[model samples]
Target: MQVELNSVWQVNGVDGLEKALYRVLQLYMKQRVVILFPLSDSKALLRPVKIDFDNFSEAIKVGNARPSRYDLPYYQLQYDDEISREHLTKRDEKYTLIVDLVSNPDFLLSFVERPRSKLVSLHAKTHNTYVQNIYRALNLYWKYAQERNALLPGYKNSGGRGKARVAGEIKRGSPIQLSSSSIEAPKGVNTSESDKELFIKAMKKFGLRGEEVKFSRVYDKMLKEYYAEELISAEAESREAKVPNYRAFIYWVKKLIPTDTLIRKQTNQGDFDRNKRGLRGAATDHTEGPGSCFELDATVLDVHIVSDFQRNHVLGRPTVYCVVDKESRMIVGLHVSLEYASWRAGRQALINSFTSKKEYCAQFDIEIEESEWPCSHIPLRLLCDRGEFICKDAENLAVPLIGHLSIAPPYRAELKGIVEHRFNILNEKLVHELPGTTKGKQYDRSVKDPRLDATFTLREITKLLIDEVLEHNSSIFQDLAKQSILLIESGLSPTPLNYWNQHVKAQRHALSKADEVHVRSRLLPTTKVTMTGKGIRLNDQMYFESDHPDFDAWKIIARNNGSWSLDALVDHDNSSLLYVRLEEEGSFIKCYLKKESANFANRHQADILFFKDWVKLEKNKAKPSAKSIERHNRKKQVIESAIEDTKLEPKVGSKSKRTKGMKARRREAILAQRLEESGAKPDQEYSSVNSEQSSQRIDDDRKKVISILKRKKVTDNET
Candidate 1:
């Protein structure tokens, strides 16, 4: 049985558990294995009977009184959580009580359930014996109650008088109701039946115990479906004209936009509307005047043709420059040429347009029925892009006869967008309809495309352009008659020739019949030099003297390939070698030197060295001294020793013998003989003469001593 005597964690108090201790005795003391609860009671165990209290009077009473369950020997298990003098003195005392109050569980019980009397007794032990007597009196009362069994309601005393209270009456506490039915209601509070019912329904719908359904997912799905429906309806509503579909818009953006910023939302509405709107209505009021604005451009043909005269038995194909009048949209000029878009080509086209006879012009002159003056009436402004031809001097495209020409700005394709768009339409509709266009279809399957040979020459590309232009003017008509106004006013014969003649005839300073080569004052300035037959003419002052020795027996071509100064080209009489001016400015300059001229020049000043000789003379000025040569040799030796590990063998095909035949064997034998002569033989051990001599003396001394001893022995024996 475990016994306990209660104490407290604090100084003075009557603990609730300690007040109920005697009642526990009434309930459980009858058992043979009695466990005195130190957690609830500070009862001292004496010799005869248990005091079950810490005070002296209670101990005396318990020692004398006879209780029913006093048969067993008792142990008092008191715990002192704090090391105090009162508790220490009590521990040191020699009472007939076995007190154990040291270990963890015992201390914990006393600490958790300390009684007020025990706390009082602890103070009394230090203060006065009177307080101790009071503690003892309370302890006696506790013992008396335990013997009579007359304690509180929750706990019974030793006698049966406390039994009725333990059964029904209150002891430790006053009469109180703990059951929910017996609880008193607070005043001035009321609840309706409807409110309660509503609260219950709300709890069932959104309570913590059940699964919660989120409406956001459903809302998102509904939004997506709604967006899809709205998009479909928007697309259906916008099906007007030749607008592109959504798929085409995607394709355009994919091809054009940068990958990182290629978001559909970032696309501009203006660009979208423009791309969706296809080509329409070529006519506009922006056309300048009759023959004032000309649209000139070249287009490449899809067809391929052979241009070599021997193979094809055909002249070169032609390039036609079709200049359309801005008002009529009619061809003011059309000419074919072997050159494609070159200055020569464009000049030829311009010349051919104006120079064509009235008879030939009349043949295709449907626009102007019958007029003698025909195209020779009006002044014209030739409009085209800033191509090489349109920007060249008189002999090229700016013939004195041709009118003022205008050039479009660089990369502003929209200025020439009229021609570009027209070309596209022709290719899609008319050009592709031709047999020439379909010729490339056969080479589509070849790994080495046959178009390599069949590709269109510049001539062929020209003819195709001409044919397309002529067909467009004759066959195609404007739906609105006003659209044809520009075409009619642009030319006489409704072609290139009509416009050129009109431009030429209206010229203020027309070309004289004699001057085929126009020498414009603007081209040849007064200060600039010129090339003539006389040679090196500066501002028309000739300087070349063919009779001079420098030019003897030589043909000199006096020409300047457009540099600041004249360049001399003197050819040898008997040889193909040409000598050019080497040092004209009293300074050395590189020139093509004929061997003969070079020899002559050197002979004039025999001792004077040329640049190459001077270079050699400077290099030979400083040579290495003997001491430096010796140091270099020593350094070279060191380098050779460092590199000796490299075993060099000649290549097999080289002049030296590579095979291990007679020559290799002979070389090996010679090397071995040299090694033997040097005393580098593998089996030879080299010892110095000094070490050999010292060892030789020791051996000789041993032989000499033995000889002496033998002689002495012989002598002794004889005696």
Candidate 2:
């Protein structure tokens, strides 16, 4: 077999051989060639060798040159040179070549035998096509090795037939693939449009730094859903169908909605035509003053006062009754309570909102005392729901104090839309959004109790209320007010104090001391007490005369409920009692006692014990010790006499045997009486026994009985 050049190229013998081998390898690497060869002396010398460069074969035919019987094998000579090893060349450019021929058989037999290509011929000669092809591959590998050696720096071996072994160190270093630096993209090339957009938007909205937001695995998925699926292709002209993934679709949808949105629509009552017809901006013009548009609304708190003593002085979360200024959006007054929402709450809220001196001055920066300020320029036009709290007054008595005139949104709630709108904003922006809430105090307000995990104490709740108030009052609202006062103060603008001073003025039309006194009188305590025919008796005091106005009126004097030390009302002011008439006790006398203290003495302790236990008892059940008094009264006459005798002498210790015996007999009689009282009957003969006969049971009984009878006789005679 002979190899032919596919493409002719110019070179010397060895160089041509190397070039030819390289071409073959290039074809083999490209999977183009099936076989390769080194130039053969003649066809017979061409035999297979290993494919590696070390075993590459360059063939030479000596048809009659091997005539001697002792001639070394011709096949052995084929591998004498580096180019004769195999079918292809192997590149190991870093290594240097060194050949050692082992002429001594003894050293060759050892495990450390060195190669001496001229001496031994161990491999068998075979003409197998597969083996021959392997040889061709080895020769081709040699060509690449020689070329690599030529290009490698500091390589020394040249034009030698000796085999080369790797020398020095292979370095044991990692390949070029090992790297520490991140793969940086080219300058100005941003790969993620979606990420950049999100980062920018977030930075703008939240005032966050760009680097503060990072892209997690979730961001990738979001991008795929939003940009890949949901965003309208401006290229196409219609809204796209939603993606299957809920979170991604929701994200896109959320982005579409305005971040801060306000919606105002007419209710079932229809358009607010009255205001519409008057002026283009009549609402603003009318609400020009501080008190111009009074906004009244109820805020229900989750806090409640837990009266269940088992829980102890727990303050319940409270709901707030709020009245705000429509023009300023400032909270006018807040009445917090645990009671259900009512006109009373609203009225009280209204009162509190308008009354505070601080609220009036909040709009202005200049410090002004209450005396210096004037009444609010705006009329006290009240705005609120048409609920009972706003309408009722004859019963709660708060109606007359509310205001001169009030206007409610008649069918269309949007007429008084400011308060309602403010409530929603305030809840999300303040109350509901607050952390760490608690119970309400017994302040006679109507706040509810919050649950335990989030329940804040009354003090905590109060502080939170104040904090929210400050936030609402001083906070920069985006829509109502053009710029956020809070954010502005943080950066470009002055403090809220400065803003108020510059734009707003203090309003002074607050309640006077006299008005406060009158308001206090309305809330005075008027407890009911029974009347005697002679005078109005309170407790045991009797001083008022029948002619007094209060005597027949069944009257009471009004006083502040907080004064626990004050005595009951009486007609005779000179007689110490405030309202009692100056007269004697009439045909019948009436006594007044605390409802909790009116009970029999014998069971007093148990009654108190019952009181102590009352908090633990189930509702609507009579106490366990209710009849304890009846049980104590079942005592014998002798025991009763002994008790009276002991009381007379006041002895601390040492009683006579007769006295002890009488006491024992009394105890037995008491037990018997108790049994009867408990619905049991005794034998009749036991009751009829004489005292003398009973004395036979104990000698001391006679003496004790004699002493008792003698004392009784003397007492009877004296009477």
Candidate 1 — which residues are off by over 4 angstroms?
Answer: 1-283, 312-320, 357-379, 389-404, 421-430, 434-471, 483-719
Instruction: Enumerate clash totals for all models, in the order shown.
Output: 29, 77
Candidate 1 CA-lDDT value:
0.38
Best-performing candidate as measured by lDDT:
2
The lDDT for every candidate, in the order shown, is 0.38, 0.39
RMSD of each: 54.5, 35.4
Candidate 1 per-residue C-alpha lDDT over 166-195 given as tens digits, one digit per residue, 9 for 90 to 100: 222222222333578666632211222332
Candidate 2 residue-wise lDDT, 295-414, digit = tens: 676656644433222345444455666666665555556655544566544544544443434543342223445433222222255666666444446235544444444556556555
Candidate 2 achieves a global lDDT of 0.39
Model 2 misplacement above 4 A: 1-285, 302-317, 357-379, 389-404, 410-413, 433-454, 457-460, 478-514, 519-622, 625-719
